[model samples]
Target chain A: MTPHDLKQQAQQQLAQQASLDWLSLPQKAQATFAALDMPTRKTEAWKYTPLTALLNTPYFAHTAAGQVDESAAADRLGQLGDVSRLVFVNGHLHPGLSSYSDLENQGIVTLFSNANDAQRELINAELGTAFEPQQHVFATLNYSCIEDGVLIQAPTDFKVQQPIQLVYLSSGEAQPALAQSRVLVYGAAGSSLELIEQYDSLGETNVFHNQMTEISLQPNARLTHLRLQVEHESLSQVNGLHVKLAAGSHYEQHALAFGSALKRNDININFNGSNAYCRLNGVFLSKHKQHIDNHLNLEHGVPHCNSDTVYKGFITDSSRAVFNGRIHIHKHAQKTEAHLNNKNLLLSKQAELDTKPELEIYADDVKCSHGASIGKLDDKSLFYFQSRGIDRATAEAMLCLGFVNEMVEQFPNTAVIELARQRLAEFFNDVDQLNHLWTLE
Target chain B: MSKTPLLEVKDLVAEVDGKTILNGISLTVNPGEVHAIMGPNGSGKSTLANVLAGRDDYEVVSGSVRFKGQDLFELEPEERAREGVFLAFQYPVEIPGVSNMQFLKASVDAVRKHRGQEELDAPSFMKLAREHCKELKLKPEFLKRGVNEGFSGGEKKRNEILQMALLEPSLALLDETDSGLDIDALQVAAEGVNALRNPERSFIVVTHYQRLLNYIVPDYVHVLAGGKIVKSGGRELALELEEKGYSWIQ
Candidate 1:
């Protein structure tokens, strides 16, 4: 994979760009893009998730279309209703199909293309700074070729009334498409905001989605972010979400991954200020040959900070899921409270889950614990349920759901919890063994 | 489902962890009959109940348990449950994440399926569950909580009865249901048990004292000591044993 060949591939992919934004990237960006093509298992960050399946297919950068079917996009998004909605098609913002107030005038929401000189300078200073581009080839690739994304900011002393949702829908009707998106949110002191990002592909076409979202919070600010990746099973997606919390700030994230043939999500958070807090929860349901990997890293850099993480996975058929969560506390970060937990349910003998929850603490004053468990359903509980007159199959289902519901029920947002539950039900419906195990009574 | 002997245990021998517990215990119960097995601590009364319930902890070495004219040991625990064998655990295990309502629904559905009936929907199931809870004097809010999580001893006992009432097992085995109950709770639980009695159902109440037997009087009383039935008599045996203690049975 020479740089010349990579450059030619990029040129061919961007040939039909309807907008000039695709060509506006600086020369350095092009050089960086050409340096990295498709990350392989050799890439440390992408060790568990191989990108060869995606690279095997030729994927072209998606171009601005004449008009996308708004109803189709709505139908997919509405599957989990009660979410504040924003629609994006082909890596371009579609404000008409989007449902949300224009907060640009209030200085709360600003498109990356619409940012002024000052905002651009701020983004340039902070963007791609929290992550090491050289180490993460996907991040480097996304940063270099990203055409447009969303930038949201909540000023100090401001509290948003509604949750901000960004829905990204990929439409590649004719060709194998690649859609790249980025999101940056900065919350000021004493501010709070709920943000949601959803990813879905409209067509059953072979496509690739690369996305990066970053969040930074100041002292006393609170932010809850929900991310859902339910793209078409034919698509391959690699997503990165980076969050930095200042002193006394709070940040919470919940993710649900249910689609894509090969999907990987990388999440990193740093507690830079004293008394900062972070909560990360996720659920991954995979079936057939789908491959999903989630890598999470949380750094307790300051004192008196607390972070809790729980990730659950249900794998069926020949599907595989990998979860790696690591927590680190600096010597100066005394009195930190952090806990990380991961559990997986294997419904088939061929299904697999590789999970690791690691903890590194320099400060002895911290209260940190990490637990990772991979086990079949508890036969005692199953027998107990069955002895009550429940059949064996239904008994198994109830116990399985109970195992995962421990964390799902903790979601503060009722709507998000319901959506996750609905997705769980849909997944269980297809799992024949689980379908035989139990149904909702 | 007849008014004859509901459960007939013959030369029942059970073991746990390679240690023999029940050494050739025998008992029989007729439909509409209540039998009380009173004994000292570790006298194998609870082991007998557990064996009847087909607990994996205890291995039945030699036994012919005839419940409603079927080979009880041949059935799985769930199958035995469908055959009307119920054991109210002395120490009910708390399932922290499973809601009580959901647990009850699963149990009821299993029983209904065993009876070749359709599963009840949410509304009907809730109605039946509520009615049973009321009969056991259990609070409706308890259904929303995890099964036995944070429940007091008496509450767990009442929940057991509630489950028994919902399932309506023919051979209900009360394993020390009166162990941790106060007088009021004991009265309520005994009353719940009394109300479930019918011509086609039978109960084997295992207790240490004669207090519970006073509330739900039994037709026959058996004194079990050293893993065997030492004496069998009318209900007066419970009072005589409570007065003289187990030294006489030993």
Candidate 2:
């Protein structure tokens, strides 16, 4: 079927389902999706990340097909250690494989399918308010097909001790399928929460994942968000995260991704009130024939707000990557401090990277700077290592690790840091020349 | 008793970036003896030192160098380092994010493994490193920081000496180790080198000024002019050259 027919089919299927109280938003979202065109190479924001491969693929909306093995689910939860977990298999919540029975007693943790009347009212009011449907087509598509997702609410003066893990596992073993997932998080005044969103696949099946996460932080609230994406080569993913901050609220994010055949993450953060802060740190690795892209936009609309960002990437073999970071400071937002830097290392002749760091400031008293650099290893540093009895290959591996480890050392969780280190070692081991140099033991 | 020299250089010619820097230079060093090479600015003293360390930037158009009955040019830079050749650089490279302790451990272990000696464990290596740092007047905390990163001029020179003491090479090439040091720092650095002297170790000290020669006395002094050894004599030759300028030698 053509791409247009596919969208019509998805919309018609959603309209035919039993009309519920939550179906109103999806109906409106369907209209929005119909009015907008799919992103292509001609689109200004998506010039570097062509959507031809994504649009041309013939994929049907996901339906519950195969069963998830209990043992396999348990094995996939390796070493995350004593934390609340919420598992979703093929866009549906699996309560049998999930933990966190007491989180609802403390503040609020309820799935959309099991939410109470009051929780449902809150979800309906705040669900699709963080982002505009007419701007992002994938987000609109995600909302048009949304079925069930998680809604987390930390009430006033409440604090969560353990991190909450949202695990999205794809088990589309029967046929090529598409999955759409949604997450809405609310932090009330003087409350805090730590959330980790993990995406994985079970078997070697062609699947496309479209995900959207909307977060609203009330005054004096704080949130720490960590997103880890590690999937099989047969999977393609498009993720969007939209966050809004109030006065005296702080939001920090760290994203680590191992690129699939195709992956893109779009993050938008806005400072809506004064005396707010945000920091974004990311590290991405792409190998073989994979492609990865990261686009971040930070908007400072009020005075006395600060934002800092840094991203590093390692591309090898025939892989490609793109990074575009833009900071916009409005005319009245004085006393704003913003900085961004992107650095990349290309390990092969065929590897490529396109980076653009932009700053648009209309305020007179603002401090904003952006820089981007792409280059290979330094020859003098390599020779310095060789003079100390280290081989060239080993020296290269050590330098690359040191470059990426500068950001990895800042991870707040020890278990995640260990996992990231192991994954990096494996990536280096797969390269032909650096195989023997990176050893975890 | 007469014995083979520890290092022998016969008519070495070297160039860098298509320009000849060393024109037929020759020198000999015996075990337990220290030789001082003094020259004016841009007189090819550093070129000779780098060429000995197998820096690929310096091309040896025609040369022959023998170290303990083996051709030195046959090995790579790393191989030469494993075979007991140490060059104390004038300007040490700063490598951020790599702690000095880790770099030193790797270097010492590689040399020990090559010489059929057991690798030092962490605790024992720390003990040895502390002793060397004490002799060099460097703080023990220097080992925890990045290698030569944000280090002062005197500190970098002392760190280089500490490495020379730890590796314990048969032949140590000191290239302008006292150029930017104050009097007290120069004394400490010279004493660090003096403490490592033994019957089985030799040193080739390359310097421009006669001030450093006062602290570390040499058995022989040679004047390198126009990339050739024009004058060679006992230690008093350094004093004579110090009284008159390098122009007197030519």
Candidate 3:
């Protein structure tokens, strides 16, 4: 079908779904979705990734309700543990599988649908302010379909002792499906919250998950956001997170994206105040024909804002990965320090990684540097391990683990770091004997 | 029958690029002896170390190196490692993301597997590593940090010796590990090396300075120049060379 036909059909589906309060949104959101040019290879941002496979299938327009098996959902929720879980199956709230009463009572967590009018207005004011509407199509689509998601609000001077886990499960029955999620986090001054976002797919059907999360941090507010995406290999997903930081605010992000046929995570940060710190750390493992892309941008708009990012990619088989990070500093943003580095290891000759780390600085007083390297394992290190008698395969495997463990260990949360490590080990477990030639090492 | 030399190097003619570095060199290292290969800056001391470790850079034009009855050249670097041949690189590559414990475990397991031994579990490995680190005076926290990353000149040398202690290779080749070290670091590194010496394991201590020999005193001293051994003598040769300098050797 043509692009116009697809848009028309999607609009019709949304109109038929009366359970969703679609008319409440500003009229401009509908126009934004209508005008979105279906991403193709022709688009510069999606140049290396082609959307031909996604366009070929018809996705069931996401509705307010769908079939959600509690047993299957619980199985997926088990991975996140009992830490304040929020479950969404096939784009609908599976409240039976969610438990966050402690957070609700403490006034730290409030679902968007259940929030008061004042809280709703606060969330609406902060939602689309950080992310630009034109650049990201997925973010625009989420904005248009902003119906239900978790709204996290940490009161001023309150420090949360436990982590809040957000779990999303995409279970497609027959036709391909799509889900749009909106997450708004407002951390008041001197408040802290550790937020975890996890995605898991129950079935093998092709599903598309589009999500947008907006975070606004006041002065001295510390936020740690960990996003783990381990969905079915046939799913296509795109998650966009936009963070706005004030003075002395700290934001730490650790993201691990392992599955899905086509996956991309866009993180855009605006450093608006002084003494703000942000770190974006990620580890991505792709095998088979999976493709994962991470597009991150940090705008250092004010002085004395520091940001550091390290994203590692390990691709095997015919899989592909892309890491594009741009750190922009304005003219008046002096003493703005930012360092961005992207290192990728290709385990297959056919596996591809296109990494571009860009630093656009207009201030001569700022310290901005960016570097990207694409290579295989360290042969000298491999030889060092092997000369002692470790086989070539085991040596490479150990090196690969060490490579990813470097980033995983940076996670401040102990349980999350350990879980990520376990998953990483299991991810590499199959290649017990990784071919020496398979790794760049 | 002289217990069959643990390592035999016959007319080892190896070269880097088009220039011959180890020109017609030959040596034999027995299990119970410590051999010091000392030379000046341009002398092919490091070349011999690299060649013995089976590095791919050097081309063995026409020669043979044997370690424990195995064709050293026929094996890969890791294979050579498994057969108990270890080289203490003068400039150990700093692997930014690999930790000291992880690297040591992998190396030890490789060597053990090659000798038909089972791998050590976490507890045993940690216990073993901690013992070695204590003797080396290295902090236990170093095990958690990346290998040689942000390490001082002396720390890298100590780490190398620590690795040697863990691997416990039959033949350990040390290549100019004394360079860029102060007096105290030299003693610490030397003390670590001296502790690893045993009757069944031999060491080839390659250095440009005779100071390292003060602690890791070798039983045999050989002066290497122009990629070949020019002179051989007892342990006193190290002290004599330190007194007169390598200039008189010509």
Q: Highest TM-score, which number? A: 3
Q: 2 or 3: which has the higher DockQ?
A: 3
Ranking under lDDT, best-scoring first?
A: 2, 3, 1
Model 1: pairs clashing at backbone N, Cα or C within 3 Å: A247-A273, A388-B107, A389-B110, A389-B111, A390-B110, A393-A437, A394-A437, A394-A438
Model 2: per-residue Cα lDDT over B1-250, one tens digit each: 9878999999999988898888899998999999899999888888888888888889998979999979999988777777777888899888765678877887788778888999998899999999999888888999977788899989999998999898888888899999899999999999998988888888889999878889888999988888888899988999999899999998
lDDT of candidates 1 onward, in order = 0.79, 0.82, 0.81
DockQ of 2: 0.41
Q: What is the TM-score of chain B alone in each candidate?
A: 0.96, 0.98, 0.96
Return the lDDT, model 3, position B219: 94
**Tens-digit lDDT track for model 1 on B164-184?**
998989989999999999999
Clashing pairs in 2: none
Q: Each prediction's TM-score against the native?
A: 0.90, 0.88, 0.93
Q: Per-residue alpha-carbon lDDT of model 2 for A1-441, expressed as tens digits? A: 555666766666556554335645777777899998777667787887856546666555544443678788766654678778888776667778788888966646777777888878888888777776787888888877556777899888788778888887876546666677788999998899998887766765466777889999999899998777766656778889999899999999887787776788888888999999999998888889888889899989999999999999888888889899999999989999999999998888998888999999999999988999898987777766767766677678767766676666677787777666665666666777656544412
| Top DockQ prediction, candidate number | 1
How well is each residue in B9-85 modelled by candidate 3, as lDDT tens digits? 99999888989898988899999789999998878989898888878888999989888887888988877777788
Off by over 4 Å in 2: A12-24, A50-56, A64-66, A114-118, A157-159, A203-205, B36-41, B96-113, B116-166, B176-195, B206-250
- Measured by lDDT, the strongest candidate is 2
Q: Write the per-residue lDDT of candidate 1 for residues A1-441, one digit (tens) a residue.
A: 433444466566654333224224334455665666555576666677756666566564443352478777667664434444568775667877776555776768877778887677666666776665655666666666555667788888899767787888877656666667778888989999988777766766565677888888989999988877766667788788888888889888877787457888889898889989899988887888889999999988889999989888877788888999999999999999999999888888998888889899899898999999888887667656656766677677676777666656666777766666665666666676565433453
Stretch of 10 with least lDDT, candidate 2 chain A: A58-67
